[model samples]
Target: MTGGSGGHGGGRGGAVAAVDLGATSGRVMIGRLTDGIVSLEAVARFPNGPVPHADGLHWDFRALFEHIVTGLAEAVAREPQLASIGIDSWAVDYGLLRDGELLAEPFHYRDDRTEAGVDLVHALEPFDELYRRNGLQFLPFNTLYQFAVDAPVAEADTALLIPDLVAYLLTGARVAERTNASTTGLVDVAHASWDTALAERIGIPPTLLPDLVSPGTHLGRLTPELTARVGAPLDVVTVGSHDTASAVVAVPMADPATSAYISCGTWGLVGVELEQPLVTDAAREANFTNEGGVDGRVRFLHNVTGLWLLSETLRAWEDEDGAAIDLPALLDAAAGVDGPVPLFDANDPSLSAPGDMPARIAAVLRSAGAQAPVGRPAFVRAIIESIAQAFADAVHTAARLTGRRLETVHIVGGGSLNRPLCQATADRTGLPVLAGPVEATALGNVLVQGRALGWFGDDATLETLRATVAASVTPVGYEPRNGGTSL
Candidate 1:
């Protein structure tokens, strides 16, 4: 990606398409910057989730690819001046390719198949050693753990993480975008490169991993077949390629160093940014991760499961009643509950897998000697409060672990719009919560593409991008009301 206004776009300022994928859903958005105001137009949205296979849960990559291609065509039809496409999704999950042919649809991270992989990986090299090498938190679904049991790795020539796999399909390029690669548990967190020795020691061939590229690197032009389908020749640029990385890129923080962020969606990633990896024993003990970021920064964060709890509870209730629940109204009713509510652990491992979430939560509540809430509204309140409690704990631990006061907290993505959760986090953490830009991941995806096309001019840094995001979208603020806010 160079600073030029030539080729199909032929302008320093033009639109870029961002394909942002999450666990439950995916969307395509068109973004452009004009006079420092970043704007986005959502072009398409498609449902996504675990598809059960004979062996385990997996993604329907073919279906997702069809959606993506159709979405790109829609975007190009709407905006013929589309300069590039950038993709991002949840990390760790991947597709194995042999001679550019997909071996199979990738397994879903929430699948129960990684149990033996954890044991096998730990047996070869214990977790603490792995932590010092990768600076990643102990997630059972990290790519290395998944690779331990994946038979496809033995036959595949390359393994691409979700977004990279999508890019490969669109542009026929094979390369790992660094930000997402950092979460795979095979990268040298300090050097920002793959630890091939560790990878081979753990059964993954280094050849299966492609050369890494930084965000904003030009991948390639869309394939001729894709070009004909989309009605234009567009380049593919590497954005963060990890949904959380993209979300953090668009966190319109007043000051990142003194502020903690909760990239709240499927997981509430809580932490502050650093210029260097923090791989200390204390950080490892706290299960804090130092993932790579755009412009070579460190995203020192902890993952606490987020919206999945409430979403699954709602799903179970809807299945039982065969009717959709009104979430806003339920949250409003929940806010009216007067006294303290029963709280359960949001980070409990048993609550991880998909199914009967309400029952699992109730079991955890009883295990903690707290009775389940009486009704639906109370149950929802308990869930939000419990999540808020987790957020507060992570934020406090982050502050202590990093030796930062962390005066302000910024909550971006879907959970930011949850007023009750935001208020509870503020009240619990004693820090004012700034929330908005619900489409931060897509926005960040666009911002990177925009900059790559010289839309922001030369010398534009991450701060410059943050300034643009703040100007484009304002955030809602929540202050602590009760005495519990004291740090």
Candidate 2:
């Protein structure tokens, strides 16, 4: 199997289905590219969340898989011309397989089991060496730590990252996609392959790892069953399998040299795309990651705790009130508040789990000698302001560390629709902010598949695809105000 080979000049155009799985929800979007313009429509969307099992919080992978297949079927029903399929999702979390069967439900990254493993990993291999080898930040939920805690290799024949697992279910091809592999903390940054040495050091069998494939590699046609079920003989193409990686691919930057992007969703991945990995001691000290990007670029950024702050806080509020809280009303009330809001470290691990976020935030604020917000509105304001501050700090740190001057910050994904967050980030960073195309992950996924199907043309580059996005969608922008108030 291969990509579409016709050039753009040949009037080649088609639709591609993108399965974008986020932490809070999943969507199947169909992207149509014709005459160098792209358009996307959501065919299906379903809520996703952690399930509390006897052991701990675990992902409902079975439910998610069903939703993905449902989305694919809906996509084909909506657009009979759908050409290819691509899947992208949150990184690090994975499913173990034995004899090509998923062994058990995959653990949610927020599960507490990794804490002891984090300590053990550092004891076995110095943090510096891990960073130097993989260029991954020290996330307690990274696959390495998760593997350390779960120790699945003894009974597992294969480990596949979330998106790859979904892809495998569709096409029966078991391979690791590079973009997501970079987040596992088991890939050699320089070589862009599995770090077998590191895996062995951590007691993970090297053979358990799958062969690596770059984005846009054609896996094959969907299995006969899937094809017949979906009513479309679709070929599955590897994309920037990590959701953030796919989002970064569609960041419509006219000039990447002076632009930084915030892939704002459950996590605010704030960073610059660089030609090479920034693995210096400074990068390590700053806790920046060098996740792989399309075309072998590096997404050098900090994983700032993002909208999960607000969403989880709201969830806690609703749980206590036993009713759904209106988010727009809360944001409106938050925006109406006049004075400065208190700030807390959004990256605090205590706030990472799935309960009592608002209370945890209040405790952190009080510990910092800052009064907690008086009500839900104030709390919302605080979370938005804290996220904006984190974004500004990350953008500044990225520029300083990379020796580049940032002229603008682009916020993509669901958070791009967040007017308060966009404006606050601009005001704090003192740079113009561009926000839009809330479906960047899907756009990037489809664009890559489209290019492989030769929708863009043989000479098409990433920039070319981005230009199509720029033409396809209008973005809202915010300029820094108040001479950039201090965080």
**For this target, which candidate reaches the highest TM-score against the unseen true structure?**
1
- As a whole number from 0 to 100, the lDDT of residue 374 in candidate 1 is 93
Flag regions of model 1 displaced more than 4 Å.
Answer: 1-12, 483-487
What C-alpha lDDT do the candidate models reach, one value each?
Answer: 0.91, 0.89
Across residues 1-487, which tens digit of lDDT does each residue of candidate 2 receive? 3434444224467888999999999999998887678888988999998999998889999999988888899999899978789999999999999999999999999999989889988898999999999998889989999899896658999999999998889999999999999999999999898899999998899988999998888888889999988988898999999999899989999999999999999999999999999899999999999999998999999999999998888888888999998888888888888899999999987888878888899899988999898877888999999999999899999999999978888999999988988999998898889998788999999888887877766887889879889998889988888664222
Q: What is the Cα-based lDDT of residue 434 in candidate 1?
A: 93
Steric clash count of candidate 2? 2
Q: Name model 2 segments beyond 4 Å from true.
A: 1-11, 484-487
Alpha-carbon deviation at 400 in model 1, angstroms:
0.4
Which candidate number maximizes lDDT?
Answer: 1
Residues 1-487, candidate 1: write the lDDT tens digits: 3322224343456789999999999999999877668899989999999999999999998999899999999999999878899999999999999988999999999888798899999999999999989999999999898999988789999999999999999998899999999999999998999999999899889999999999988888999999999889898999989998999999998888789999999899998899999999999999999999999999999999899999999999999999999999999999998899988889999999999999999999999999999999999999999999999999999989888878889999999999999999999898899998899999999988887777766667999889999999999999988653423
**How many backbone clashes does every candidate have?**
0, 2
